[model samples]
Target: MLSPRAGAPPPSCPRAHSTYALAQLHAALAKSGLSTGSATPATAAAAARACARLGHLRAGRAVHGASAKLALLPASALLPNALLHMYASCPGDHYHLQLARLLFDTMPARDAASYNILLTALAVGGHVDEALELFEDMEDAGMAPNEVTVVAVLAACADVGDMDLGRKVHSYAKRQGYCGNVLVCNAAIDMYVKCGCVDAARAVFDGMGDRTTVVTRSSMICGHAMHGEGDKALELFAAMRRQGVRPNGVTFVGLLHACSHMGLVDEGRAFFESMEKDHGIAPAIEHYGCMVDLLSRAGRLHEALEFINGMPMEPNSIVWGALLGGARLHRNVEVGEEAIQRLAVLDPGNDGYYVVLSNIYADAGRWEDVARVRRGMKLRGVKKTRGWSTVSVDGTVHEFTAGDCAHPQATAICDTLDGLLDEARRRGYVPDTSVVLLDMDDAEKERVLARHSEKLAVAFGLMTTPPGTTLRVMKNLRVCRDCHAVMKLISEIAGREIVVRDRNRFHCFKNGVCSCRDYW
Candidate 1:
C-alpha cells in the first residue's frame, strides 16, 4: 500500500520577518501610548496574534512581557486570550503548556475562547485527564461549548478510551447541531473507532454520507480493518472508488493492514504495486513495513527477509518489528534472532523487542538462551512493560493489573473468576501454560494465567453487568493464548459476547469462537 514519503524540510517562512516586524511595531505603538494608558489591549492583542500565527514563541513572550509592563493585560480579556492562544499555538516544550495553564488560571475573567484554547492545548499536550477536568469545570461554569470544545473533549475521551464520556460528547454534539460540522463528525468517528466501537463509528460514517472526506473514509476503513473485518474494509474501499473519492496514502495503509490481518497476500501485493503505478504515490517506509508484515505474517519469512534486503531505503524498526512478530508466530528462531539483532541497534532501550525475542526463544524451549536474553536486558537496564486492562461498567472505568487486588470489588472478582475457570475446565478448557515464559510448574503457571489482567477485567465485567451484556475490555498488551482460549469458553458458558481491544487489534468472542479465529 502507498506510504507517505518524507518531504524535504519546509522552506523557512519568508513572511516570518514581516510578521516579527509587525509585532515589533505593535509593541512600540503600545509602549508609546502607555504614558497616557490609552487602552492598549487592542495593540498588545494584535502583537500576540501575529507571533502566535508565526509560532514565534520568543516574540510572543516578549509581547506578553511588554503588555504586562504597560499594564494592558487586565483591561480586557482580549490580550490574555491572545497570550493564551500564542502559548497553545507554539509546538515545543512543556514550558508553553505550563505558562498557558498559569495564565489561564490567573485570568480575572474567562470567555469561551479562553476555555477552548487551554482545553485544546491540554488535550493535544497529552494531559487528557487534566483536559477532561477542565471541560467539566467549563460545564460547571454554565459555558455553552462550541464545535472546537466538543471536538477537543471528544479527542481527550478517545485517548483514554473513555467511552462513557465519548458517548456523552457525541450526544452533546448532536444536540448542539455540531454533528453537521465535518470536523466534529470526523473527530467523533475517530473517537469511536479508537474506543473499539466499530459499529458506532460506522453509524457516524454512514450518516456523514455526502460529507465524507478522505479522513472520514480512511478512519472507517482502518477501523474495520483493525477489527478484523477485512472484507468490509475492502468493500468500503471499492465503494469509495466508485463514488470517485480519491484515496490517499493513509487509505492504502489501511487497505494493506486489512490484507495483512486477513492473510490476503496476492491482493496485498497488487495494492502495493498499484500504490506507485496507479496512484502515483511513492512507497514510504510505512508501506514497506506493511508489505513486510503481510509477507512475514503469511509464513513467507524468506521472501520477507529478501524484500527487506532489497528495500530502496533503509528498513526501520517497524519493518524489523513486523518480521520479528512473524518469526515469533511461526517459531522461526533464526529469523527472530536476526530481526532482534537489528532491533538492538535501532532501539536499544525498548523492552518490547527484548521481550519478544525472549518469548521466541522460550517457545522453542531454549531455556539457556531465554535466560541469556533476560540477563542482557538486565545489564542494559530495560524493564519489561507492565500489562494492564480497563473495563467500563455503568459509566465507571475500572483498571486492573496482573494479579491486581487493589479494587474494592477484588474479592467478588476473584470469586467470579474461580467459578468461571471451574466451569471452563468442565467444558474441556485446559490452560495453555506455554505463554507464561517463566520456568514454573504447570500448576503455578495456570494460577498465574488465571490472574491475568484480562481475566480480572472479564471477571469484573461478569460480576457487574447483567446477563447477555457484551463485555468490552481494553488491554495494554496482546492477550495471551490461554486467555484467548478461556475467553471463547467463557463466551459459550455464559452466553456473552466479549469484545477486547488489545495492543495488536480487536478480538470479539461469541458462542465459543473468536472473531480473529485464533490468528492473532
Candidate 2:
C-alpha cells in the first residue's frame, strides 16, 4: 500500500504520438512515485488533464485510484473535477460517461466547469434530452452557464431540430453578451442550419463580420449545400477566395457536396482535381465519397465504379454506399449488384444497403431476386430500420413513426391528414404506390403512403401551429418519392412553406415546387 508523502512534480506530457508514448508516461509516473502517495492535487490535476488530452483512459483511471487511496477528495475539489473531465473527454465510451456522471453526483461541491464538462459529454454521447434536462437543473440551481454550456445545448438542439429551444438559447446568449464569442456563434449557426433554417445561419454568419474564421465560412458553405443551394455555396466559396481566405479540406468537402447535389458534374470533377493541386489539401475519404456521389447521382455509375477501383486507399462503406445510392436512384441493377457485393464485405449487417438493393431489383421487375434478398435478410436476422419524423411545436418535440398513433393528438392528426390528402388528390396529387415495397394492393399501398411519418408530422404541425407558420419536419431516413410529392402538393395547397430534413439532404417545398427541383 502507498503511504502519504509531501509532493512530486507533474508528469511531462509531450505531444503523444502513440499508445507507447502514453505507456512511457505511465511508467515514468510510477517510477518517480508520482502515481503513489507523492501525488498532490495539483500534480494529479495536471496528470488528469494530460490523460484527457491524450485519451489515455487506463492511465487516468490509475490516477483516480491513487487519488482515492490518498484521500485526495477531502483536500481539493479541483482534483475530482479534473478526474470527471478526464472521463468525460473520452468519446464513445459509455462506462467513462457513467463514471463522470457518478463523480459529478457524488462531488461535495460543484462549479460551472463541472456542469459544462458533463453537459458536453451527454450531448456528444447522444443523450440529448438528458443534457437538456441537466442544463435546466443547472439553471434551477443558479449555476450560471458559461460559453461551453451554450455550445453543448445548441448541439443537442441541432441533433433533434429543436428550433424553439435553440432560439431561446440563442436569445439568452445574445443577452448574456456571448454574441462576440466565436464558439457560441458557430454553434448557433450550426444549430440553425441543422434545424432547416438556412437564412438564420446566414444571418449569424454575416453578423460575425470580420470575426468569421475558416470554420464559420465552411459551416455556411456546407449549410447552403445541404439545403440544395449549390449556386450560393459556390458563390460564397468564390467570395471567400477573393477575400484571401484559403479553403481547408472541410471547405472543399462542402463545395464538392454542393456540386454533387446540384448535378454540376464537371465542376465537381474540377474541384476534386484542384483540391490537391490548388488548395494543397489531399483528397480524404469524405472528399472521395462526395466525388462518387456526384458521379452516381448524375447517372454515371460506370465512371463512379472506375473511380472507386482506382482509389488510393481501399473504398470504405461511404464510397460504396454512394455508388449504391446512385444505383437505387437511377435503377441500375448491375451497378447496384456490384456495390452490394462490395458493401456485403465491408458492412454486411447494414440493413439499409440490403433494402436499397431489394428496391433496385423490385424496380427492375426481378421479383425472384427481391425474394432472395428478403430471405437472406431474414436468415441473417437483419431488420429494416423503421422511418420516423419529428416536428417541434412550441418548445416540445413530437415524434411520429410510420402509421404512428401514439401521440396525444393522434386522432385529430389522422383526421387532418385525411382531409389534406383528399385535397391533394383533388389537386392532381397521385400517390406513387410503386414506392411501397410491400406486396399490398394499390389502395392499401396508397393508404400506407398517405400515413408516412413526414405526412403525419406535417399534419400535426398544421393542426398545432398557425396557418402561415413555416413547418419544419425532421426525418430519420430518406424521404420516399411519394412523400416528397405530397410535401410539394401540401405546400402549394396549404399556402405554407414546408422544410423537411431527411437522412441525405434538406427539401424545402414552396408553391408546388421543391428547392431540389426533383433532382434529389
Candidate 3:
C-alpha cells in the first residue's frame, strides 16, 4: 500500500510534488552515478517514473537496476506495481515481458494489478494466445479479473481473431461488473471488428454509455468497410459527426476505404479534400494511394496522374505501383511506361517495376519494348518478386509457389483445382491469359497464368475447407488481374466465400463480386 502522504511533498520542497517531479528526479539521478548506487528506492522510483515519462528505455533500466541494488524500495504492493508499469511501457523488447512475469510470479500474493501488468506485456508483444492463457491462469489462481485485465484479454482475442474466446471474455467481463468500463467496451468493439463479427461490433458501439472516442468510431467504420457495408460505414461517420466527435486521420482512412470499396468516386473525392479542410488532418501516403485507386477505378487515369503530381510530398513505391497498375488497367501503355520510369528512378533495384512495365508492353503486343525492359532489368541486376501464398489451416500455415507441386497431396490438390476450373468454365468462366507477361505462344501463356500462387491457394482452400465455409488466404504480392477474375468465378462455382489479404488490402469475394468492385 502507498502511504497517503507518499504522493505529497514536504512544504519546504513543494516543487517536488508537481508534475515536473519526474524531470527533477532525472536531473538528480544524472548527478548520482549508478556505480555510486547512493540513491534510495523512493528516489530511484521517481527517476524511473521520469524516464518512462520521457520514453527513455535505457535510463529507466539503469534506475531500476540501481533501486534493486540499494534495497531502498518500499516493500509495498503499489510501489512494485508502479515499477512494473515502468518496465512494461518500454518499447517492444522480450526483456520487458520477462521482467514483468518475474515480478508478478515473485510477488508474495498476486493481485489483480500484478496480473494486469503481465497481461498487457503479452498483448503488446503479439503473444495473444499466451496472454489469454495467462488470463485463465489468473482466474484459476483466485484473482478476480479487473477492467484492465478484460481490456488486455479482449485485445489479445482481437489479435488472434478468436471470436469464441472474445465472446467468452466479454461474458466474463460482464459477470465481473467490468463491462461498464469505457476502455473495456472500446476494446470489445475492436475485438469484435477484428474477428469479423461486424454486427457484434456495432452492438458494442451502440451500447456505449459514454461518448465514443475517435478510435472506437474508426474501428467500427473499418469493420463495416471490410464486410462490404459501405452504407453502414457512412452512416456511422455521419453519426460521429452529429455527435461532435471530430474525425482524425484514422477515421478518414476508414471512411475513404468505404467509399473506395463501393466505387463512390464523387464521395471519395469530397472526403479526400475534406480531410484537410474539415478535419485539418494531412493526407498520408496511404490516403494518397486510396485517392489514386478511386480515380483510376473510375477510369480517370489523367486525373489520377494529376493528383499524384499535385501531392506536396514525393510519391513512394505504393503510389507509383498504383499508377502503373491503373495505366495497365486502362491500356494506356505510354502512361504506364512513364510511371515505370519514375518507379525505376525512385527504387533502382526493385524488380516489380520492371515486371509491371514488361507486362504493360506485353498487353499492348509490343514484343520489342518487352524485350528491351527485360534487358534493362538484366543489366541492373534486379530480380522479380516471386509469387507466394500461405494459408492457415488448423493453426498451421502452408506455403505454395507458382506451379509448385511438391506437397504430399500435390496430386489431389491439382485434380481438385482442375475440377473447380471445369465447373467455373461450365458457368461461363474464361481464363484471361493476357495477364501473363511471357513472350511465348498462347498455349504457354495460358499454362503460366493458370499456376499462379493465389489459384493454387484457392484450390487448396477448396479441397481442405468444408463446403460453404469461407476460406481466407494471404498473399505477399498483389493478386494478378486474371487471378482476381478467376477468384470471382471460383467463389460462385464453389459456393464459398473467399477473403484474400494481398500486399495492398483485403478483398472479399462472394457470389462473383469482389469487395474492391473491380477497381483494384
Candidate 4:
C-alpha cells in the first residue's frame, strides 16, 4: 500500500510510511517537516490528518493554506476530503464552525464523506438548517449516503423539528438497506421522537433486530419521557431489566425525568435509591437535579430543601432552581426566600431568581417586598432574557416573542387571538394577574399575558395551518399558568391537537386535556 505518489514514504521515512497511522505520521511531520510547501496533495493530506489527530489546529490551518496555494486541492477528492475533515475536527469555537463551512463550500469536489463530515460538524454546532441543506445537496448530487451520513442527517432533522423530512430520511435509509444498522436505527428513533412521533420511534426501536444497545434503549426511554408517556417509559425500563440489558447513568436520568414528569413521587424516590443499591451507579448532579424537581413538583418542598442540604456534593443552580420553582408554584414565600438567598450567592447575576422571588411576593400581595426585589434587580444590573417561541409548519419556521405584533400575518393571528379571548371568557379563562408582578392595571396585565410568545405562536399556527393539522409550538421558557389554561380551551375549540414543547417538557392538548395531567 505504500506509494510515494499518495504520500507513502519511501524506504527512508519509516514513521510516515503508513497513512492510517496518524500518531506515527504526526511524529514524522514534526521530525521531518513533511508539510513542506512543495509537498504533494497526498503528503499534505497525511500531514493534515496528523495535525487533526494531534489537535494542532494552527499547523492544520497552515496545511490548508498550502494545499490551496499550491493547487493541490484539486489534485484528488482524497486530499480535499482529508482537508475537509481536518477543518471540521480542529479545536476551536465558532471560528472552527465558520472555517469548516467555508472549506466545505470552497471544495473543488466532494464525496459522501465530505458531506458527512461537514454535516456532523454542523449538527454538533447546532446548525440544523445548514446541515439539512447539505444533506439535500448530497442527494441532489446523486451521492449514495452511508450509515454515518444518515445518522447525522437524522440528528439534524430532530433538532429542526422537521417531521416531514425525517420521514423521507427514514424511507431513504430503508431503501439503502440500512434498516438493520444500529447506528441508523438509533438516530431514526431519536429523530422520530423529537419530531413528536413517539409511535414511529418505538416502531424503529422494535424493528432494530439484534443490533440493540444501551444507547438505543436510552433513546426509547427518553422519547417516552419527553412525550409525557411516563408509564410506557417505566415499562420499557422494566423490559430492559428483564432482558438483562444493564441500565447506565443516562437510562436512570431518563427514568427519573419520567417519574418527575408523571408526578410519581414514590416511584421516583425508589428509582433514585435503587440506582446506588441495585445498579451500583452513584447519582450524578443531573440525577440530584431531577430528584429535586420531582420532590418539589410533588409538593414536598421541605423534603426537597432537606435533600439539597443533605447532598454529598454541593448543590448547583438547577437543584435550587427546581426548589424555587416549586416554591413559586405553591406560593411558599419562606422557601422562596431561602432559595433566593442561595441563588444570590451561587448565581448573583441571574435576573430569573429575582423575578421568581418577586412574583412569589406579588402572589402573596406583598407589594413592598416585590418593590424591594425589583430595586435590588436594578441595582445589581441583571436583566431577564426575552421569551421566544417558534412554530414550524410546511418546512418553514415562524418565530414570535413577547409583545410581538410585527409578524407578516399579525392581523390574522391577532384576530384569531381575539376570537380565542371571547371563547376564553365563556370557558372561564381568567388571567392569573399574579404572574404580572408589576403594579399595573388589570387590562394591561391581561394584554401582557395575551401577547406572551407561546400564545402568539399557537395563534399563528392556528391561523396559518389547515384545520385538523396538529400545531406544534416550541417555547424558550416554561408555559405560564394562564397560558397553559388557555391552550387547553383552545385545543377544545379548535378541535385540533396542540403540541407545545416548553423548557421543561412536552404538553399535548386534545379535547381540553393535556398530557402533562396539569402537573408540569
Best by lDDT: 2
Model 4: per-residue lDDT, tens digit, 96-156?
6687788778887888788888887777677778889888888999887788778888988
lDDT of 3 by residue, 27-123 (tens): 6566544446565555555666655555455555566666667664445565466667776774266776677677667666567787787787788
Q: Mind giving the per-residue lDDT tens digits that candidate 1 earns over 1-520?
A: 1111122211321234454455464554455343344537886687677666655666567677767887787887899999999888742347788999999998988988899899988888788989988988988998778898789889999888888889988998999899999999999998998887889999999999799999899988998998889899999999988999888999999999999999999999999999889888998999999999999999999999999999999999999999999998898999999999999999999898888888898999998999999999999999999999999998888999999999998998999999999999999999998898899898998899999999999999988899989888999888888899999999998999998999888998999998886765
Query: Which rank order by TM-score, best down to worst?
Result: 1, 4, 2, 3
Give per-model TM-scores: 0.93, 0.88, 0.74, 0.90
lDDT of 4: 0.83
Error of 1 at 327 (Å): 0.6
Which candidate number has the best TM-score? 1
lDDT of each: 0.86, 0.88, 0.76, 0.83
Model 1 alpha-carbon drift over 4 Å, by segment: 1-39, 66-72
* Model 2, CA-based lDDT: 0.88
Better of 3 and 4 by TM-score: 4
Question: Per-residue alpha-carbon lDDT of model 2 for 416-510, expressed as tens digits?
Answer: 99999999989998889888887768899888898899999999999999989999999989999999999999999889999999999999999
RMSD of each: 5.6, 4.3, 6.8, 5.2
